[model samples]
Target: MGGDHGLAVTIPAAVNLLRTHSHVFVHLVGQQVAIEQSLSRYRNLDPTRFAVVHANDVVTMDDPPAQALRGKKDSSMRVAINLVKEGVAQACVSAGNTGALMAIARFVLKTLPGIDRPAIATAMPTMHHGMSTVLDLGANVDCTAEHLLQFASMGSALVSALQGKMNPAVGLLNIGEEIIKGNDTVKQAAELLRQSNLNFYGNVEGNDIYKGTVDVVVCDGFVGNIALKASEGVAQLMSGTIRDEFQRSWFSRLCAVLAYPILRRVKRRLDHRRYNGASLLGLRGVVIKSHGSADAFAFECALVRAHDAVQNGLLEKITQAMVPLSAEADAA
Candidate 1:
């Protein structure tokens, strides 16, 4: 109910997931009346598989993180997360305010044993016809070298679990590929990564992201968020230019008809909906943050992501990976 389109998009997505994934059960945490009204549209919904828990309030997009935490005790976002904390649900996915979700999640679920702060990790389509997991996407703005190393370790574990890669190569994002190029934090983090058991690939530039130079890329939240937004902007600009040029003239329309199949393939490749969910790694419970403006298809992608994370034992994998690292840290 907290998303941009509210139950209008989320309910349909939930219904679709229930229909397609027979192994999955959904607990809709929001106003029961609205949820029932939306579910009424789909006559074939299974009552046993889909249930709605009542939430009195909603954490709006504009609500400050602290205010949302203090005031909205019975909000949908908080209740959904509570389900995870209580082991009633394996994971929680929200398209609500990011700050509110993070604040409430950290408060309720808490961080993992060895993690200082949770980092946001998302899959980005790469030129190699694969995806790269980039972390610290607007979770922690300022990070120490230790935090960066933790992000790398968490990211490596995530990719291994979700992407089925053993010892996936990890890269530290920097201005240049040279070891001496980055700031103190990045340099220090690089040293830590190299000394660890991970498959560290040294420093990689911004262009390396699209090149798929590594399976995972690590950076501070401030830089990672900027890079993500800039890439999205460029994709939007290119899509718009293609649409405008195709509709400019009769000849262009004819060209568009002839090139329709190729354009469709390109569109599918770059569809943001395909990569809708951003996992908040380093949390004890799985929490996926869908884009606030996401459509039903995009929201469904987030649900699928949460489902996969639970089935793959993402939490267990991260915990096991961190045990040795924690011991090493203590020894040092």
Candidate 2:
């Protein structure tokens, strides 16, 4: 009961997921009556596969993170996270307020040992028809060199687990691919990454992200957030411009008709819905944040992400990967 459409979006997504994944169980954490009413719309849904865990309050999109954390303990977001903490749920996925979700998740589940801050990481479609995992996507606006290093470690582990890349290449996002191009902080982080056990691929420029130059791209939240939004804007612009051009005149319309098949394939490849879930890495429990504006298909993709992370033991992989970082810290 937290996103733009609340139960209207989530209930349908849950139904769709259950239809495809026979073994998955769902906990609908919201008002019981409303949840039941929504679930009643669909036909032939298995009752045993999903259950409603009622939550009294809701964290609105405008709610402050502190208020969501302290004032609304019974909000759907908080209660869902609590289920994860209590071992009743393996993971928690929310399309709620991003700030509130992060604050509540960090407070309730706590960060993993050796993690100073939890970073938001997500997979983006690359030019090579592959995916690149980028981290610190609006989680930490200001970061130390050590924090960037931590993001690299967690991101490598995330790709290794989800993408089946045993040793994912890691790159530090910078102004240029040259090592001497960034500020002191980035230079320091580069040195740290080079010294670490990760398979660091050195500095990468913004365009290299789309080129699939590395499996993991680590950057501070400010740069990462900007990059994400810019890429999204470009995708929308390209699709929209193509549609408008096709509708401008009869000749263009005829051309569009002839190119319809190719255009359809392009639209499918660039669909943002396919990449809706963003994992909150460095948390002890698996927590995924979905875009609040997501529709049913996009939300289902987020659910699939949660399932994939659980199946791959994301938490355990990150813990094991961090051991080397911890050892280095102890040695220092």
Candidate 3:
């Protein structure tokens, strides 16, 4: 009831997830009649696998976060999060308004004990056919040195829990690899990371992100969001250029046909749909945000992320990782 395609995308994605994950149960939190109607389209689905939890309203894409938080308490987004808070659901996933989702989640679940704010963390594809987790991807545009340190801790926990790396290296994103290259806030954050228990790898440039220089890259939301969008732009441009070049002549068209198999594998390797979910880290409960324009496959990917986080004890891992930081603060 919230994303660009509403029931069309989400209902199919939920059905697909139930088919694959035997332990999963879905609560379709929207208008009960409409949700049931969509669920009826799919055949041979187990009735006990999911149930419709009625929601009276929806938070639109253009609604202000405050309005969604206060005025639309009964909206689908809010109701779903409420389920998480009530212990009825282990996690909440939404392809709805980002600001509204973040605001409502922070307000309802609150941040974890030692976390000042909740940062959005997602696994970014790297050159080595692996992934590096990056954080604060539009959650907090301005951050203090301490906030950056918090991001590093949460990101390390995410990578560890998901990828099975006990000590994931953390890198501070900067203009250059030099220690003195960044502004005061970043330099201060670097100093903090060095003294902490995390496996800090010092400064890394933008290009090093794809180079797999570290398992985690920490930055404020302003810079992180810009980097994310720029990378997306580059990927789209490269793909478009290759397609245009291959369509210019009969000889090129024949070459494209011959190279189709290799190109398909390459495309699958870097498919953005596989990495669709972004976790709202630092929240007391698990909540995932999906891209609003996602198709069924992409939405299913987001559901997979939410499922993995729960199965892997992501919340407990984050809490354990933050203990040293909390102790340091107490001593200071």
Tell me the spans in candidate 3 whose CA falls farther than 4 Å from its real position.
none
Write down the RMSD of candidate 3 (Cα, Å): 1.0
Q: Assess candidate 3 and give its lDDT.
A: 0.94
Candidate 1: the clashing residue pairs are none
Model 2 residue 202 CA deviation in Å: 0.3
**Candidate 1 per-residue C-alpha lDDT over 209-279 given as tens digits, one digit per residue, 9 for 90 to 100:** 88899999999999999999999999989899999999999999999999999999988997889999999
Reference-based TM-score of each model = 0.98, 0.98, 0.98
- Top lDDT model: 3
In candidate 1, what residue range of length 10 has the lowest lDDT sum? 42-51
Q: Where does candidate 2 have its weakest 10-residue lDDT segment?
A: 263-272
Q: What shift in Å separates residue 232 of candidate 2 from its native position after superposition?
A: 1.5
Error of 2 at 284 (Å): 1.2
The list of candidate 2 runs beyond 4 A from truth reads none
TM-score ranking, high to low:
1, 3, 2
Model 1 alpha-carbon miss at residue 195, Å: 0.5
1-332 in candidate 3: lDDT tens per residue? Answer: 87899899999999999999999999999999999889888899998989899999999999999999999989999999999999999999999999999999999999998999999988888996988888889999999999999999999999888888999999999998888899999999999999999999999988878888999999999999999999999999999999999999999999999999999999998998898999999998999998999999999999999999999999999999999999999999
